[model samples]
Target chain A: MRYIASAVFVIGVFVIVTAVTTQHAAKLDPYMYDYMIENFEDDTHAKNAVAAILLDYRMYDTMFEALILLTAIIGMKQFLPGAADLRARDELESVDQTEATGEQSSERPSE
Target chain B: MSGPVSDTMPTDESIVLQMVVGLLYPFMLLFGFYVILNGHYTPGGGFQGGSVLASLFVARYVVYPVDDTDTETLHSIQRVFLALIVIAPSAVLFTGVIARNPEFRSLYLTTMDVLIGVQVGFGLGVAVLRFAFFQGVGKTWHL
Candidate 1:
């Protein structure tokens, strides 16, 4: 059942993508590339248009790109077992103290 | 994304293989740096060079799993790059606008490319380290 659901979902995505990228929609920005290439050296000062667009014209995107990479790095670090040991140890210690005091384990670890 | 971490480090001792891989590692890193350095004049740029640099860490991890830096130091280095990547553009823009220096415009682009390369390289290294070593998962960030 899960596999069937996933297959249907994927098929739906493919159909949606195909419909959205039809001939007219795909050709909307056809001349934009020519314009960019023409203005590349004059406005950007760099020999490469890819570099100009990526590094200068759309620089804000580069900053966001850094943010995205940092977020992914931080996300992966958070999942590492060593990263959580300190908090887990603290929680376990609090649980042990709660048991000794005959208090409910449901209570948060204040210490 | 949090799943059971697998021990992927090789425990075997292959002297020939290790030596060959070790030799290739430095050269690959040099090539990655070259890609970054020649980004504007050539075809490569920040992401391309950044991925090249990141692949060094990935390659080292593949060869020897135990070879990784401490997370604290990695975190500090990444933070520094992150700050620079974020701040340098603003500084350049300020120079371009305030000082009205035309040269700073191109400098701004090249500068960001270099900063992005460093930030991305270490960011991936940390991510790879986290995957290779399983200390546990926490909801908060240390860096």
Candidate 2:
């Protein structure tokens, strides 16, 4: 039952993405591409046009990409089996007296 | 007690794996740095270089499992790198520093690439090691 549900969900997503991309996809504008290729070196002082776009022209996107990476790390630290143990020793010490033992036991019963 | 209290790699006594990784680790690191440093001039950049470097940690874990990594330190360093990644560009972009000295633009690009590379490399290394440690626990939480 779970497999069937997952399969249905996956197929639905695939169909939706395919439909959206094929029918409603935005057309590419060649202006930005031409501008970046022609002016990136002079504007950004980088030899690579792609690098110039990523680091200079479209920097905010890269910043958000880094933030997303950090968020993933944070999320994993919070939800993983030994999540509590990911905290720094000093932080743990300040927060709890018993957990300061500095030993991580994944099998510890829930409080 | 079954799970590692600290970051630990799982190891085996396979000589071939150990020998091959021992030979390959340093080169991978060198290549990762090369890719990051030459990002503006070459096809590679921060994300690609960072993943390459992170693969070194994963390779090391496969070769010899041990407590070689300090997760807390990596975590702290990654945070710092992320801050620098944000601040470096913002400082230059907003303050018109790059405009004042056009020669500084390339330098800024390289610096941003390095900061991003470090952030990504450390972030992934910490994640993989922590996941390995989590798996070592041999049990899962119900909640």
TM-score for each prediction? Answer: 0.71, 0.74
Q: List model 2 lDDT by residue over B80-122, tens digit each.
A: 8889888988899768889888988888989988999999999
Compose the digit string of candidate 1's lDDT tens values, residues A1-111: 999999999999999988877844744675877888898787767888899778766778878878888887777666655544755786888778879998875675566
Native contacts conserved, per model: 0.84, 0.71
Where model 2 places Cα greater than 4 Å from the true spot, the runs are: A1-25, A81-111, B1-12, B135-143
The CA-based lDDT of model 2 is what? 0.81
Query: With candidate 1 superimposed using the best TM-score fit, by how many Å does residue B9's alpha carbon deviate from the native?
Result: 11
lDDT per residue (tens digit) for residues B43-121 in model 1 = 9977888888888876765556553357768777888988987777677664476246666666766777787787887
Error of 1 at A11 (Å): 6.2
Which residue pairs in candidate 2 have backbone atoms (N, alpha carbon, C) closer than 3 angstroms, thus clashing?
B9-B65, B11-B65
The 10 consecutive residues of candidate 1 chain A with the worst lDDT sum are A78-87
